[model samples]
Target: MNSSEIIPSLEQSLITTDRDCIQLGSEEVATILVNLKSEEGEIIEEGGADVLIYAEGIEISETEDNKDGSYRAFISGAREINEARVGFRLDGKPSTKLITIRVQERCPEPFIDFERTQLIAEPPEILNDGKDYSTLLLQLYDREGRLLDDKTPVSLMANSGILSSTVFDAEQRLFTAFFRSRRVGEVGVYVSVRNVRYPVTIGEVRVVDPEPPEEEFSIIPYESHTMLQSSSLYLQAAGSPGIDSTKGIHLRWMLRGALGELHLPKGNLAEPNQTFNRSEDYVKIYRAKYSKVSFTLNLNRERPAVIDHANRLWIYRKEETREIYLYFRNAAKYDSLISNMSADINHSNFIALYHPELLEFECKDDLFLKLV
Candidate 1:
């Protein structure tokens, strides 16, 4: 109270006369000014004050009193992007109005920080299917933990049985690498800056064979049929070369009758139910109830013929004899939904026109058939 009653108070503040922001790597002088006012509402000549400064990500090299209720702060060596506050108090009274100083990067040096790098795979694993692919994401940064603004080219190398391509998005500071596995094995991926001596391994991808089908089981026909006709039929079967654990199996029933041509269902013929085999390994049994059979006649043409089933039953005349074919394959699932293989079924016995239709067909490779 005694000092407040005798001395004037400091009011109105300004930094660098008008500027409040400074760029990094700059040797700039910032000045703070305040007006000393007397209790009688008059400007004071002999005003005394103590100045204080607070700053982050930057250093305040020096501070000087202007001897007229003002102060000057020297700013240098900005370590990061941040702001600083400067203020003063007159005659040990309350502090005057504060001024802000913003420090920004002047020049950016772009590079990859392998120590703090992050990598992510969309599906997290690769399958043996040639078409089953995964997306790899990478975020790049500089030595100072700051995101690099400029686009940087990165080189990528992979171990055996893997294919990849790199792409960078400058606006988002994100890099994406598309990868596809050729075989089932452990694949290592690495990245490096141009001209850098050693490359760092981004991650290791485990390439696994597409799950094999369960062993051949039994196909149980719930309904008896000697003379094929338009009728509701229920059937169930158990077997192996089984469905994939993660990706279920694609099952379809094809029937060719004496009167009607080859018949294929619109969707999957059987729904897989979990079952245990004699060896205690988990297996799947497929079952379905068909109200009616739909058939499409295969045309004799050089190119593969496409059949359009208009969601109707292709019924056969009463007393007509028919042959049934059961087909099962693998499927792929992801973050969104499952992408099923093409519905077209290929037979190895292309020349045999009247042989018993192959119930369980196995392909040497992962790609069974492509869905149109």
Candidate 2:
């Protein structure tokens, strides 16, 4: 790595595209520019060894803009261009020389919409049959979420393909296969997803049988009971426009069996909903709320995980909605604080809501079962 003095120059930039031209949405070339000006308001024109420029998948367009009075060259096509510097000796030199600028063709468009994303199945439930081991046909998209390609592949796997598996398309999203129980028992499955457009994993999916992993537990009283199995509950979060990262009732719970899946309202999460930059205000990506939901499932220990926090366990119908709210908050350890908590329903799964902004512990308002 040789260090040298960078030449200061103006309009002596580099804007190169892998393709002289690219198909709309087709990620291909790059374009770059480097303009260095001195106090004289003149672009430095001296090229130096210390200053070098390079690029990938970027293009330099000739579209002149009347609005800015500069030839129109956007971070073309929404691809991100890394901001770089032209090194100068600065060894008491009256002026520094200039180098070149490298524009890039990196895709800046979010290929997957966090909100419009959906995990789909081919023949519905993907039941196992004969020599065939079900496959999930997937499709990916941009923020608008129009299918990027129609024939994306999704896979499934488990402990030796006996429990669960992973699915990946060119976009690299995952969906686990919950094989129809050969005989109806407790089955465990895990799912993780990815895509080229995403720097990290996009989503995760977890599946458990109609029964919670068996273990030891205690019980609480719900007075004057009628319809033991007639009551159920759910938690929902809204993903829409103009949702405040802070304030008011953002979530709703349902008494599934109580009133046949009717939603009841709840407040927002604790403060500090999301992060912000010095120039930009706070922006919210997701949020929601929850109320206690319960059910009953007969169990006798055909599983594991002895319930450690039964009173903290619950069950809810699975669905997405907007009328309700559920936001997220971050901690020092770098984990998310979803809504209040979950509780035990019956022999089935446990439930919790993600009211991202609030912490049940921080809120003054009591979190209780107030009939909606």
Candidate 3:
């Protein structure tokens, strides 16, 4: 075919629109439709043609294919006073015709989606350790249910806690921040949109001091021989603050065995007759004591070999005293460590003692028993 019969002229093509102009920040979007025709006024239905809508301060969706010779495009005014330029070109040809649409100035109706906008804490609660924290989330949207523009300024402030930052998420659709506190008090979080509107209260979170630990301790006999006064035992102790804490606490274990001289590690106590062990370190979040404590017991004499049933071991803690009797007669026959024993027995004339009951009730004991 000749060039005039093959190509369509831009002047002969028909351009139509649903509206002459679009109102900025309006919920209603504008649509534009274009139809191309050959020199003889015949509709050109050939595919692979270059058709596009270019605009400044406007958001455009992908051009929709009309199957016939016409195409449809959607445009939304993004700036108060801007314009959009619509054009089309056949394959391997430059754009021949251009259409301009005016954008009318308007104010957007912005509101917070209270259902979607929320403040959540990772742990729901925190300690005054200066290390624990909670995550803060906030989201804002316009009347059209679209996220506010990234350029929309925001202000986030915490009354009593530490705020990591007031920045938005990577996608710039949500605001994420971290809150922490070193003092025991309540934190009130507030947020502002565009820096001119009234602040929105996120909610309150509490920062509390670590709960004092309910310290527990006990003594257990590992092995013993009735013929010889020599015996071995394990001193186990454990306790933890309910929450995390930087200010460490103290746990002490003291002993008093009158029937025989104690043969064990040096004592930290002032009294010579009372040997003691102690732990003074901070406790981490959701964990037991900072250290595991277990000590061994052995009889010490100027000379070895002596049996006694009145042998006693005592524990001094929290200004309270507890005692246990160690018998040399049934040390081998009544193996307390192997049999079922009450865990709360602070005083017993036997060989071993376990607290909070035995973990391994069968022949296979726990690692703590194996270590003993």
Best by TM-score: 3
lDDT of 3: 0.50
TM-score of each: 0.29, 0.18, 0.31
Top-lDDT structure, candidate number: 3
Ranking by TM-score: 3, 1, 2
Query: What lDDT does model 2 reach?
Result: 0.30
C-alpha lDDT (0 to 100) for residue 78 of candidate 3? 52
| Candidate 1 CA-lDDT value | 0.45
lDDT of 2 by residue, 138-223 (tens): 34445775654424322322211122223344455434343332222222222222211122323322222233222211122353
Candidate 2: list runs displaced more than 4 Å.
1-107, 120-139, 151-205, 209-372
Displacement of the residue 150 alpha carbon in candidate 3, Å:
3.5
1-372 in candidate 3: lDDT tens per residue?
Answer: 322244655655545455546676676666666656554443455434466544444666777767555667877745567776666554535455555666777433335564556666666679987678777766766556767645765555554445554578857467776777766877777655543223356676788987633221223334332222212322333435525433455343343352123333433433343323343222223436446755343322111122222332222121122122223333433345435542124223222333333222111121234334
Backbone atom clashes (below 3 Å) for every candidate: 12, 57, 1
What would the TM-score be for candidate 3 when compared with the true structure? 0.31
- Which tens-of-lDDT digit does each residue in 1-372 have in candidate 1? 122343553442222322355566676544434434433322233334554544444566455665654455566556567777755544455454455666776533434577887777777787867567677777766687876433544534453332444567776677776666556776666654431212367776677877644322223333333233222232223244455423444454333232113122223333343221223322245557645434442322222233122311112222234322223211111111112222234322221331342223222212223221
Off by over 4 Å in 1: 1-111, 214-372
